[model samples]
Target chain A: MVALEFWFEFASTYSYPAAARIQAMADQAGLTVVWQPFLLGPIFQRQGWHDSPFNLYPVQGRYMWRDLERICAALNIPLRRPSVFPRNSVLAARVACAFAAEPWLPDFVRQVFHANFAEDLDITKPDIIQTCLERSGISGHRIIERALAPDNKDALRLQVERAVALGIFGAPSFLAADELFWGNDRLEQAIAWCKVPSLVGIA
Target chain B: MVALEFWFEFASTYSYPAAARIQAMADQAGLTVVWQPFLLGPIFQRQGWHDSPFNLYPVQGRYMWRDLERICAALNIPLRRPSVFPRNSVLAARVACAFAAEPWLPDFVRQVFHANFAEDLDITKPDIIQTCLERSGISGHRIIERALAPDNKDALRLQVERAVALGIFGAPSFLAADELFWGNDRLEQAIAWCKVPSLVGIA
Candidate 1:
């Protein structure tokens, strides 16, 4: 089975849904999903946005929240509007980057999203991410130490650079053999593209 | 059955697919699709985007064109990258707005899209839109006169304002009553919302 690279940012609202459901969907289609966690701050800044585009344009932001609510309702996922619009996820991303190949990375990803979006908790604090790590069935102390190490932080920075090289401009992007599909809405289509690489591509 | 309002801008690439396929999908769902032609220029300007966000941000633009190619290929719709990235569609939009209630408005919409995307013709010109009108089985001369009328022009401006008021920041947006769905990707979900409004919405 071909691998689908699931590139996501922890602070992205759309990535929350993509993180929650991508694995099961990919498994059914016989695709292996590579959970790529990266920060959107540098990426957005490169595109001349100092903040989430949603916050910059409140009208689109309003529609986005409404759309997200509908999507969450359809999927039966619990969501609460985060008190802090987009919580800092640098340390969380570093943890995921440091252990990208871990068997329990997916669980940790979901747990962090749950903390921020489902529970409306501030994910930036070390204690919250520590709780998330514990919830993902891993002891928090050692991972947090390694996650804050210089090497892991550098790895996370490079991950954002690599994402830009692959033409990913937003979170919840899927890369199937260099074909990029953006947004949670394209996850199923990305899975299908992996299933039959020839059927739905022009490149 | 509830009605689904399709809001489109002629220069929006995703709107091409939505315009081509929305009518049939709405028909199957026993829903009436009210075609709304609006300009995205004023809306984007208000949001501080001087050009199509796709163009202003080239990475996203690259993905969009490739994604559009994939979609058009999958749907067996002919596509050619227009010489202009986003050809001006003000006049075409006015033509659409002017004759929106006519039975042939849908055909005219498709023709204008084809002229710009498939045929690589300038849709902003009077001749091009007149050709589109004739292809839709309507006489072009008087309609162009009416479309270019000051009142019709103002109506198109008001349409864009109405779109902004509804929190629409992008093209190919669907409204099931007051709920908004953005992008061609959401067309199916929007239709589903129209079909069984309660099952797929929080609003």
Candidate 2:
């Protein structure tokens, strides 16, 4: 069976919708999903972007907000625009890295995405993150502390570097083998590809 | 039965994928799809954009090319980067407008999108467009002539103006009732929303 990897950033709004739907779709298609969470701050800084591209372009940002609302409403998901643009996602990414091997990692990532984009919560705050982790019955402090460890930080850096090497510059990216699908909307195509390996390398 | 409108532009890359798949998906969902082709130039100009957002941002443009390749491969679709960036789509848009009510309109739009982005053809050339129309079993001269008619030009402009009024600033936008889904990736969500009228206007 072909396995698909979902590389997401907690600070990304579109990742929220992708995360919420990817697993169910993958299951229906009989594919394995690997959740890989990485911070987009490093990538954005490398590109000299001070904020999300949507925010950098006002028109794009306006359309994005409305688009997200329509998607959430159709999916029957609640959403509120975050007040703080581009909140610190380093801690969240770290927690994700530390729990990558755990069974609940995917769920944790989805919850964080929802918390930040749907509930409009500051996912970077210790209390808010701790509460989110506690709700999932995990030790937030332990996860955060472990995430800050030298090895874990190095691993996260390496992950971002790999993404750069793989030609990825955005969130909600999917990797099916060597192919990359960027954006939340490509999630289905990514999954569909996993069902038929013969379809790879078409052009 | 609910009718959903798919508004796409020829210069849009992702629209090729959605245009190819939407019909099959809509059929499965028991929904009617109204294919609407409109020029994105007016919309972009109205929003103060000189080019596609991808072209405006270098990093985005580079990543988009790579991402499109990966997606095309996964979908078993042929794709090649267009030689010309932002080809003058006026002729193609006009032709599309002329055939908007015809059954072959969807195939024409799909073929043009694929030809522009996949085959790397010069879509602005009348000969190339004429050839494409001929291959699709449509009258190239008649369509082009009708496209230039005063009424058809007015209709195209009116369609673009309507898009601006709807707050759409991008191509590949899907509208189900009053709900709007932006981007090629949102095709599925837009179709799904059409199934449940109660979800409309909730956003």
> Largest TM-score belongs to which candidate?
1
Best by DockQ: 1
TM-score of 2: 0.79
**Tens digit per residue, CA lDDT, model 2, B1-203:** 78888888888877777787788888898888888888888777765678886887676788778767766776777888888888888888889887787888877877788789888999998888887787788878877888889998898899888887776777788888677888766776777668764545443
Q: In candidate 1, what are the lDDT values of residues B67-91, reduced to their tens digit? A: 8988888888889999997999999
TM-score (all chains, Cα) for each model: 0.97, 0.79
Stretches of candidate 2 exceeding 4 Å from the true structure: A1-3, A20-34, A66-78, A102-107, A149-155, A192-195, A200-203, B20-33, B45-49, B54-81, B102-111, B114-119, B136-139, B142-146, B149-155, B200-203
For model 2, name the residue pairs that clash.
none
lDDT for model 2, on a 0 to 1 scale? 0.80
Q: Model 1 segments beyond 4 Å from truth?
A: A199-203, B199-203
Docking class of 2: acceptable
